[model samples]
Target chain A: MDPLSLLRGLLDTTEDAARALVGRERIRLAVTGLSRAGKTVFLTSLIANLIAAGRGARTLPALSDATGGRIRRVFVVPAGTETVPRFDPEAHLGALAADPPRWPERTEDFSTLSIAIDVERRTSLGGLLPERRLTLDLIDYPGEWLLDLPMLRQDYATWSGETLARFRRGVRAAAAAEFLAFLDALPADAPAEDALAKRGYTLYRDALRACRDAHGLRFLQPGRFLNPGPRGEAPLLWFFPLPEGARGGLADLCARRYAAYLDDQRSTFLDPYFSRFHRQVVLVDVLGALHAGEEAFRDTGDALAAVASIISGANWLERLLGAAPTRVAFAATKADHVPTRARDALAALVEHIAFGARGRAAQSGAAVSCHAVAAVRCTEDAVARLEGQAVAAVRGVLLQDGRGATIYPGEVPMKPPEPDFWDAGLFTMPEFRPPRLDPAGTSGMPHLGLDALLAWLIGDLL
Target chain B: MSGRPTPRVILDEGTAPAPRLDFGWEVQVAPPVPPARGWSTMALIGLGAAVLVLGFSLLEAGNFVAAQFAQAAWLGWLTLAVATAGFGLVFVAIGRELRGYLALGTVDRARAAVARGDPAALRSALAAWQAGLPEGRAKPGDLGNMPINAACALVEAKTLAPIAQDAAALGRAAAVQAFAVTAVSPSPALDALVFGWRGIRLVRQVAALHGFRPGIAGTVSLLRRVAVDAATVAATDVAVDAAVRGLLSSRLAEHVAGEAAAGAVAARRMMLLARAADEACRVLPR
Candidate 1:
C-alpha cells in the first residue's frame, strides 16, 4: 500500500477512535454529479429540508415517516471544521431566497457540512428511550473532479493512448485540432522545457473546455485542467496526455508529471473521503443531456457508468481503497422541468442510463435506486388546452423573459430516444426561473420526489 | 404565502382549465416546540450546580476546620487532611465512573458501525471489540475474503454466541443462589446482604465475560437498562417468563404464595438481565 494511503487509513482510524471514545455515530454522504446536474441545489435543499423538518415544516416526509417521527432535531455543526471548509447553508439558502430567487452557486471544490440528527428510537420496552444522534457529514465535490476518478487505474501510457484516441473522434477532433497541431510540432525526443509544457497544457485545457462548451461533451480527463481548483494554473496541472509510443525527453517529462497528477488524485481526492462514506447520491441532468442531443447523452451515460462503477465495477480497487458505497441513488434532477405523467419515464431513462451502463453494479448488493427529483421546484404542474386538446403542461416564470407561461415542455422517453424521436423534433425545453422562497427555508422548499430519494438513500439510518 | 402578485400564465387560443398550483408544490408549516435545550446545555447546567454545591461544602468544611483549630491544634490538622483526602477520592471515583460510561458507549457505537455495512467499519469495529478480550482466544477459521454480512454473522455466532452461554450460566447460578438464600434466610437483614452481594457479583462477572466491565455508575446504568429490557422481554415471552407474567397479571391466586414466589420473581429478573447484557454486547449488523 502507498504510504499516503496508510497515513489516510491511520487518520480515519484515529477519527473513528475519537468518535468511539465519545460514543458518537457518524455517516459521510458524498453528492456528485456532472456539470449542470444541479448538485448545489440538491445539497442546499437537502440541508434546508432537514433543518425545516426539525422546525416542523414537514419537508422531508419520507425520512420523517420512515423513523416514525424518531428524528428529534437537526442542526449544522459549528464552523470550526478541521477536515474541510464548511458548506454554509445560510449563504446557499440566502442565494435561493434572494430577491428574484435564484439557485445556489454550483460546487466549486469539495466542502463539508456536518448535520447532527437526534434520532429517538424506542427501546425493546418501548419507553424511556434516550435519543441517539447520527452525524451526517454531507460532502460536495466539483463534478469535474469525477472525470479524474477513472485515471486511478490507468498508467500514463494507457491514459495517453486512450485520451489521444478520444481526441481523434468526430467533434472532439475538430475541438482538439489546435492542441493536436501543437503536439505534432513538439517532438517527443526534444529537451524538457517548461515553456513548451505550459503551451501544451494551455492548449489542452482550452481543447477540453471547447469540447465541453461547443459540443456539450462531458468526459474530459484531468478535470482540474479545465476548472483549476484552489491550485490555480499551477505547473502540477501542466501536463497533457502524449501520443502512443511517444517516450523520453518532453514525453518523459509529461509522463512523469502525469504520474504525479495521478498520485495527487489518489492522496488528496480519492483516499480520505472514499475510505469513510458508505452512501452516495449521483445527480444526473438527463434533460440537459437530452436537450444537448445524442452525443452529450451518451457521454452523460459514460460518466454515469463511471460514477456507478465507483460502487461495483472497480470493486478490486475500491476494496483496496476501502471505498465502496453499499447503497447508491442515481437521480435525474429538475423533474419539474417535465410534465407530471412523464416523470416515470424520466426515472426509467436515468435507471436505464445508469444501470444499462453497468449491469452488476446495482445487482451486487449495492441497493442502487433511481428517481426523478427536483431539488427546488421552479414550475407548477398544469394542464393546458393546446390546439383544442388538453395537453399536460408546466406553468412557471420563463427563464428567458421572466414572464409566466404555460408550456408543453415535451415528452420524456423511458429510454434513449430513437432516431425518429429526434428527427420529429419532440422536445421544446424552455428553462424556468425559481419560485420565491423563505429566506430561512422555514416554509420548506418545493421539491419533486426528493423525499423518495432520501428514503432510498438513508432511510434505514433514519 | 408570498406578498408578490401572482404571475399570469399565457394560454393558447383554445379551451382553458387555467393552470393552478398542484399538491406537489404544497407547503405547510406546523407550530413546533423546539428541543428547549440539547444534552450539552443540560450537562453544563448540572455541572455548574455540582461545582457550586461542592464549593459551598468545601467552604463549610474549611470553617469547621478553623473552629477545630480554635478548640485543638492536632485535631484541626487531622480533620483538614481527612477532608482533603475524602474529596480527592470522590473525584477519582467520579472520573472512573465517567470512563466506564464512555466504554459502554464505545460498545454501542461499535455495534452501530458494524450495522452500517462498510467493510472498513466492520474490520475496525471488530478489531476494537476483539481488543477488549484477553489474549490467547482461538481465532476463527474462514475469517478472510468473505462478504461483510457473512463476516458479521460469523462474528456474532463464533465470537458472541458462546459468551452468551457463559453469561447464561452465570445468570443461572446467581438466580438459583438468590432464590435459595432469599427464600430460606434466617433474617431479612442477612437475606438483603447476601442478595445485594450476589446481584453486584453476578453483573460484574457477566460484564467481564463480555469484556465490558463498567464501573459503579455504568453498572448502575446498565442494570437500569437491563431491568427495562428484561421487563419488556418478560411481558412478551409469556410462556417462558410465567413467573414475571404472574407478577404483572391479576392471577396471583394461581401460583406459589409469600416470599418463595417473590424469590422466584427475583431469580427470573436476574436471568433476564444476564440475557439482556449479552444481547447488548453482540451487535448484529444485518
Candidate 2:
C-alpha cells in the first residue's frame, strides 16, 4: 500500500476506536446550494431552531430528541479546524432579528460552525443510557464553487469544447454571443499574450455573470468566475477556454493555468472539505428554476447531477477505511411557494431530477434521499377563485412591492418536464417577502417540512 | 398691508420669462437611417483592384522589367494575392463590426428607456444593459444603485415605514448597549471597540433588507471606504444628513443618528462611513 493510504487507514482506525470508546461521534454536515437557494437562511434558521429546541422551546418537533425531551443542551462551540473561518451565526441572526426581519445574505465562501448537542439515549436493553454529546459541525459554501468539482477530472480542451458547445445553444448562445465572437476573432496559433488573455477572461466572466443574473442559467462553470473568493481575481483566474483545434503558445498557456486551478481547487478547497464531511444537503431551488423556463430547469438538473457525482466518487482509501459514509440529501427549497397539496409532487419532481445521481450514490454504499422543504415559510396556502373556479394558491406579501397578493402559480408536474411542457407558458413563481416574526418567538422562522428534513438528516445519529 | 413697505416682486431682465414653465415632455425623434450594407466590402475590393492594376503597370514600365513574358506571370500572381487579401479582410471586418454594432445597439436602447424614467421600463432596461455589454464593462448608473432603488421602491410601495421603524428600535437597543459599555469602562479604546462592533451589526442588518451580505472583510473595507467617501462629499452636518438620507431611506435616518449619538467622535465618523459604504456597495453584482 502507498504511504499516504497507510496513513489514512491508521487515522480512520484511530477515529473509529475513539468513537466506540466514548459512544460519541462527530458529524460534519455540509450545506451548499446554487445562488438564491436560501442556504444562508437555512443555516441561520437551523441554528436558531436547534438552540431554541434545546432551551425547551417549541421548535423542530420532528427531531425525535427535541420532541421526546431527550435533548439536554445545545450550544455553539469553537470549530475543530482552526484554519477554517467560523460561521458568523450572530451576523445572520442579527439580520433576521432586526425589527422588520429580513433574510440573511447569501453564502460566498466556506464557513464552519460546530454545535454540541447533549442528548439522553436509551440502550437496546430498555435501560437509560448515559447522556451522550454529539458534535455537529455545519459547513456552508457557495453552490457555485461546488459546481467546479467535475472540472478536476477534465482537461482544458475537453472543458472548453463542452462548455462552448453548451453556450452555443438556446439562451446561452444569445448571452454569450459577444464572448463567442471574441473567441472567434483570436488566432488559434498566435503566441500567448497577457493583454489578450485578460481581455478574454474579462469578457468571459461578464458573459457568465449576465447568464446567471439576467437569464437565471445555473450551469456556468469555473464557478469562481462568478463567486470569486478572496483571491478570485488573481492571475490564476485569468484563463478562458480557447476554441477547439486550438494549438500553440496561447492554448498551452491556458491549459497550464487550467491545470493549476484544478490543483488549487482540490488541495485548497474540495479535498479538505469533502474528506471531513459525513453528510451533505444539496439545496435546489426547483420552483425557481421551473419558473425561469425549461432551459434553466434542465441546466439546474445538470448542476445537481454533477454535485451528486462528486459526492459518491470518494477515493479508494476512504472506501477501504469505511469512514464517513456520506448520506446525501437533495432538497428542493422554497416549498412554501407551492401550496400544501402540491408539495409531494414537488418532491417527486426533485426525485426525478436527481434520479440518476441518487441511484449512483446508493450503489456506492451511500444513502441518498430527496425532499421539498421551506427553511423559512413566507406564504400561506389558500383557495383563490381563478377563472371562475376554486384553485389552490398561496397568499403572501410580494417581495417587490410588499403588498399582500394571492398567486395561483401553475401546478408542479409530478415527473421531469417533457419537451411539450416547454411549449407552454412558464409558471409564475412570485418572490415572497418573509413573513413578519417577533425576534423573541419560540420558532425562529416559520417553515414547512424543515422539522421532517432535520429528522431525516440527523435522527439516527442522535 | 401690515408691513411698512410691502416687498415688490422684482424680476431680472434675463429671468423675466420666469423659466417658461415647460411641463410638456418631448422625446426627440430621429429619422431612421438605412443600415450599412456591403458598401465597405465593395470599397475594399475596388481599392484592392486599383492596387493590383497600378502595381502591374509600374512593373511593366520599370527598368527592372527585362522581359515582356515576366510581366504576365507577375500580373497573374499579383491579382490572386490582392483578391484573396482584400476579400478576407472585408469579410473579417464586417463580421466584427456587425457583432459590436448589435451589442452597442442594445445598450443604446436601454439608455433611452432609462431616460423615460419609468420604473418597470428602467428595470427592463437595466437588465438589457447588463446583458448587452461586450465585457460587462458598464457600471451601474446612479439610479441603478440597489439600496437607493430598493429604498425608493419600498417607500413608493408603502413598505419602507415599517422596516424603518424596526430598524430604529434595533438601533436604539444598540445605542443603549453602547452607552452601557462606555459608562462601565471609561476607556476610549473600549468605547471605540464597542461602537465598531455595534456599527458592523447595524450595517449588516441594513444590508440584509436589500439582500446584500458583505463578509467580515468586505464589511470592514466598506466601512473604511464609506468614511473616505462621506468626508469627500459632506463637509457640514446638513450635508452629512442629506447624504445619509439618500443612502438609507430618509425614514431610517433616526436609527443611524441614534447609533452615532452613543459613540465617540471617531466611532461616530466610522458609523457614518459604514452607512455610506453599505449603500454604495449595494450596486455591486453579487
Candidate 3:
C-alpha cells in the first residue's frame, strides 16, 4: 500500500472511532428459539411495546419507568445490511389484525430489524446535557439452525455415530425405520451412485421430518434438510448421516457433502449473524416439551446445553475477533397456557432446564437469566368447581371451536418431574385463541411478564 | 426348489450421474488488519493526565500548608495545571463521543441506502463501514456473493410465476367450498382430510408438469404420501399457531384454505422443479 494511502486509512479509522465514541450506541439483540417457541411473537410484541412506550402509551410499565420517562421517541429504522432479509413486522402485524386473525408464517431464514430510542440523561447536574439515542438491532433466526453449530467441531463419522445412536432409542426409532432399512441395504464400500445417494437422502430427510412433526423431538440435526429456505432443492443439502465404521466410495461421498454442508452453514449462516450477536434471548417451549414426553424434555435440555457450549466456547481466533461479550436470557414461552398460580412452577422448570447452560455461561463471564413470559396473553385466570371444591382454572376461547371454555389444566411440577410422574398422566395443554386487539396500533396486545423481561434485558441501558 | 436358474435380476440405470465429491476444503483467509489505535492511545493519555491533575488538586486543597503557596508564581502554576487538566478532560470526552458518533453514522448511512432500495449504495456503504473499523476489529466478510444470490432468487421466482398464477386460480375456486365446510363443521380430523385432498390435487398437477404421468392408482398412492407430508407440516403449523398466535385452530384447515387462496402448493412445486432443473442443468455436459 502507498504511504499516503496508509496515512489516509489511519486518519479515517481514527475519525470513525471518534464518531463511534460520541454517537448513539448500537446493541445487537439475537432472538433465537426452537421451532414453535414463540420467538416471532416475542419479537413482535417487544418492538410494538417499545415503540408504544416511546410514544408515551405506557404499555411496558417496567421499561417505561426504568427509562425515567426520558424516552423522547422510538421508531423503526431500515436494516443495516442488504445481504440479510429484513424482518417484515408489517406483514406479521397485519396477519394478527385481519378480520379473523391468523398467525404469521414461521421464520425459515434469518432476518433483522432495528429500533432507535432517544432517551434523556438523568443526573442532578446533567440538566444541560442533550438526549442520547440508542439503536437496537434485533436479529431473528431459527433455533434448529443453531443446533448445527456442534457439527462444525465433529467429523462425519463421529456425527453419524452419535446421530444413529440417538435415533435407535425412544420415539425416534420408529420414525427412523425406513431410513435405517435403507442404510442397512447399502454396503459402506459400495460404489458411489447418484440413484443410491438420492434415495438415501430422501428417506433420511423424510424420517427427520417425521421425527420432528410426529414425535415432537427437538434434537434433530442437519436442520436445513427439513427447512432448506433459499438453498432449497440444492445438491449441497443432499447428504445424510451414514452408519458408523464405514469407509469406501459411498462413505467418502457422504463425508465430502457433510463437510460442504458445514462450510456453507458457517460462512453463510453463523459467521455473518450468530457470531455478531451482542445479546441473545433463547426461547424454550418447556411446557410443550414436557407434554411430549421424557425423551423430548431431555432432548430440549441437551439442545440448550449444546447451544450454550457454542456460545461460550468460541475458538481462540473467533474469541479474539468476534463481537463483544454477549448477555443471554432463556425465556420459557407461552406462560398463559398454564394458570397464573402455576407460573412459578413454570419458571422453576425452565430454570432447572437451563441450569447447566447458565452455569457454563456464568463461568465464561457472561450474564444468564431465565424468565417465564407470554408475548401474547391468550387466557385469563378463573375458578372452576371440581368435586365440590374450588380449583384454579383458565378461561379462554377454545381453538377448536370459537366457543368460550374454562380449563383446569393439570399442575406443572416445581422441579424436574420424577419418572413416576409420567405414569401419573401428563397435563393436556390446550391452545387458546388470541384476544382481539386494536388494529389501529399496538396499544392493546395483552402480554404477561414482558415488562420484567425488558427490565432484565435492557433496563441498565435505559 | 427347481433346478432351472432363476431369472437374473438387474437394477435399473441410475436416474443421474453420481455427484462429484472432491472434499476440497477452502482455507479461511486471514482476518482484516486491526484499525489504527492512535485515537485510543491519545484518549487514554488525556484521561490519565486529567485524573492525575484533579487528584493532586484535591490533595493539595485538603492540606493546610497549600494556602501558603498563594504566591503569584505558585498560584499561576496551579491555575495553568487546572486549565491543562480541563483541556485534557475535554479531549478525552470528545474522543469517546466522536467514536460513538462515527459508528452510529455508518449504520445510519447504510440504513438510508437500504431505505432507498439501492443495492449498489448499500453494498458501498457496508464496504466503507468495514474499512473504517479500528485495528484488531473483525470486519464483515465479502458481500460479493449477495448479487449472485439475489440473481438466483429472481430467476427462481420468474420460473415459478406462471405455476403460481395457475394455482392461485384453482385455489380461488376451492376456497368457497373449503370455507363453508370449515365453518359448518370444525373438526381437526376433517380438516386434515380436506388438506390431504388438496395435497393430492397439488401433487398430481406438479407431477403432470414434470412429465411423470401417473394413472388413477398411482395418483391415489401419491395422494397418500402427500397427505402424510401435509399432515406433518400441519403439526408444525399447529404448534406455531399455539405458541405465537395463541390460537388452537386446526393448522391443516388453515393451511389448506390459505394454499387454496394463494396457490402456495403449485408455487412450491414449481420452486422445487426450478431447483431440480438447475441441478440437472449443472450436471449436463458443458
- What do the candidate models score in CA lDDT, each in turn? 0.72, 0.66, 0.65
Q: Model 3, stretches more than 4 Å misplaced?
A: A1-20, A79-81, A125-127, A314-324, A386-389, A424-428, B1-286
In model 1, the runs with Cα more than 4 Å from the true position are A1-23, A81-83, A122-126, A311-322, A356-360, A384-390, A424-430, B1-286
What residue pairs are clashing in model 1?
none
How many Å off is the CA of A371 in candidate 1?
0.8
lDDT of 3 at B58: 60
How many clashes does each candidate structure show, in the order listed?
Answer: 0, 0, 28
lDDT of 1 by residue, B134-180 (tens): 45544344545786656766777777777788889988998998888
lDDT of 3 by residue, A343-378 (tens): 988888998887776776666666878889998787
Give the alpha carbon lDDT tens digit for every residue of B170-227 in model 2. 5556656665676466677887777777777876665444333445444554556455
Cα lDDT tens digits for candidate 1, A287-402: 77776667777888887776555535535444344445667788999899878898999999998777654365564456678899999887877887645667777777655455
Which parts of model 2 are misplaced by more than 4 Å?
A1-6, A65-68, A79-81, A124-129, A315-317, A323-326, A440-442, B1-286
DockQ-sorted candidate list, best first: 1, 3, 2
